[model samples]
Target: DAGITQSPRHKVTETGTPVTLRCHQTENHRYMYWYRQDPGHGLRLIHYSYGVKDTDKGEVSDGYSVSRSKTEDFLLTLESATSSQTSVYFCAIRSAGGESRNEQYFGPGTRLTVT
Candidate 1:
């Protein structure tokens, strides 16, 4: 399993304000992903990074942005926080190869509340 952690385990913010969440891993994995978990919707992908400075949008990319400047850190920013954006955000690292190639190790979630 990969070693991962997320910052600001819980947060409350006003609508339209900018919010940023951070994810860090110690395994030096090449693929990192951001996903939001909400009622009924399950975990939906927000963005992912393949390598340092190389990123891509995911299924739920609107209003969300991600960056990876180093192999150990990934950041997710909400340009404008909204009520609908309130959810538990998760950071995951995919195993590069081997038996667990498709397996993803997740970090403790960051719970965000938008008022």
Candidate 2:
């Protein structure tokens, strides 16, 4: 919720193909993050952005990339699809200076399958 949305809620792609997922938030928070949820991995960070044009890679970022060009939009790209990358992807936005400051609120999620 919190005005957050992920595009192509579900997708199926072939291995080695490129894929890109979009995350949009109207909350205007200072931080946005991308994570993937898998049966064994639970949740692992893929990438995150603190502000427009500022981002950093996370633990499972070997084949992933991210970009944020504006406050409300962040993009996650899978340079090459892989079966191991098939999982539910989540987008989270940090609350801006509230009782929930630094607390992340997640979007519904995007499910990707690589064959």
Candidate 3:
């Protein structure tokens, strides 16, 4: 499980509605990231955090927001979800230093649909 879990594993919502997805980790990783996977775009980064309350925008962050209040929890929010926002959301964690320093372990993923 990589000590990661995403809430609302499957969700269906209407357009213009606000949605929030949560990612929790038990591995005490120092870095957390949120990404979206689409048919043509593969996986695109939405946001990331290097430490608690320290976050930054990523490649596809226009319609999304993220917050990391604690080392074990990262949250991704869609202010107003659209059909274009429908995709599989993934949460990944990486250690700051170790043998697997560069490796990112991902969660099972959350499937979101905006209709």
Best by TM-score: 1
What digit string (tens of lDDT, one per residue) describes model 3 on residues 11-105? 99999999999999998888999999998899999999999999999999999999888889999999999999999999999866667658888
lDDT of 2 by residue, 1-115 (tens): 6999999899999999999999999978889999999886799999999899999988989989998999999999999999988999999998867665557899999999999
Task: lDDT for model 1, please.
Answer: 0.95
All candidates: CA RMSD (Å)? 1.4, 1.5, 1.5
Estimate, for each residue in 1-115, the C-alpha lDDT of model 1 and write its tens digit: 4789999999999999999999999988999999999999999999999999999999999999988999999999999999999999999999867865678899999999999
lDDT of 1 at 4: 95
Using all chains and alpha carbons, the TM-scores for the candidates as numbered come to 0.95, 0.94, 0.94
Candidate 1 matches the true fold with a TM-score of 0.95
After superposition, the stretches of candidate 3 with alpha carbons farther than 4 Å from their true spots are 98-100
lDDT of 1 at 48: 97
* Per-structure clash totals for the candidates: 0, 0, 0
What value does the lDDT take at residue 93 in candidate 3?
92
Candidate 2's C-alpha runs over 4 A off are: 98-100
Instruction: Return the lDDT, model 3, position 35.
Output: 95
